[model samples]
Target: MKTIALTVATAALGTDAFADSSLPGMTGTDHVGFTVPSVDEAVTFSQDVIGCNVFYPLGPFSGGDSTWMADHLNVDAKAEIPTMQLVRCGYGANFEIFEYTAPDQDTKLPRNSDIGGHHIAFYTTDMDGAVSYLQDKGIEVLGNPTTMTDGPSAGETWVYFLAPWGMQLELVSYPDGKAYEAEYDERLWDPRP
Candidate 1:
């Protein structure tokens, strides 16, 4: 495996080709958070079901923000609201999964049908294992891991699914992924190391 140096939170909040903010209630990467029905459930799926090695328990415990940016530059310095758990891929970026307290509730992304919206993607070396693990756990995949015939990833295989909390999640694999780390960018959604 190899390593890249961009801060997970920073890259997650950067501009895309169009330069519009792709994520809402987010800024400076770490400002992003996914509200799950249960923090423990979210942790299990990301760890055992998804085969990710858990990092600090319920961690980065402090210092993650979920406030929208006043300016695209970043979240406010004084921004502090709810707390979230940060997880990273075995070798890449970090993901922040938040559990609802009482006032907070699970919310939807802008919806893929709507513009400036999206789903979180997870990379897998074994797409079959990835699918099977989730399925065996009674987690149904929303759709098959279809092959992309479109844009930058004109020939990638991807499967879309939903987390217990209804947060959209995706699993993806490529033919020559051993060298995939070199092409890392703000778009790569990795698990916590």
Candidate 2:
């Protein structure tokens, strides 16, 4: 069992396994897709609060009499997408916001501890001002901004908040860069322009 566990860990880490095989002509991420309870409401918040620019909107698609939805999107065959739109915020990856309808749809927002749970983090130079702005807009700011003063994350500050639909969002700032920057050549994607 120990040997099997080690093998699995090595495979997951990809230390040497499948080193040569990679996606051809691959580049950095272009966009991140997520479904929201209401596309219009999501777009409004993204635009009015987050300052995102909404791009072209897509159609209300259905699978009809086929299993195209299940086969292609891995969703229920009868699932439908009522509305979808692409949004660009700052210099990070664009967002593909979707509104889906299905018989088995789950409306509850998952906690960060749950599998497949996620949040969109925005970078800001003024963490305090951003938190105050959210509060002024009646947005739910989870707690005070946490500043990491030690370890690799030193010089970083972050706080989580919630969207009107209960989706998780975060504000992160590291104006002077994190401590890890000095120890490594490669760095995480910087949102600063």
| Alpha-carbon shift of residue 35 in model 2 (angstroms) | 0.6
lDDT of each: 0.61, 0.90
Q: Residues 66-179, candidate 1, lDDT per residue (tens digit)?
A: 334324414353333344567775564577666543323225556777775678787777788889888888886987788766566755788988767666778888755324
Question: TM-score for every candidate vs. truth?
Answer: 0.58, 0.88
For model 2, state the Cα shift of residue 64 in Å.
0.3
Per-residue accuracy of model 2 over 42-84 as CA lDDT, tens digit each:
9999999999998999979999989999999999999999899
Runs off by more than 4 Å, candidate 2: 1-21
Q: Which ten residues in a row have the lowest lDDT in candidate 1?
A: 61-70
Reference-based lDDT, residue 145, model 1 = 80
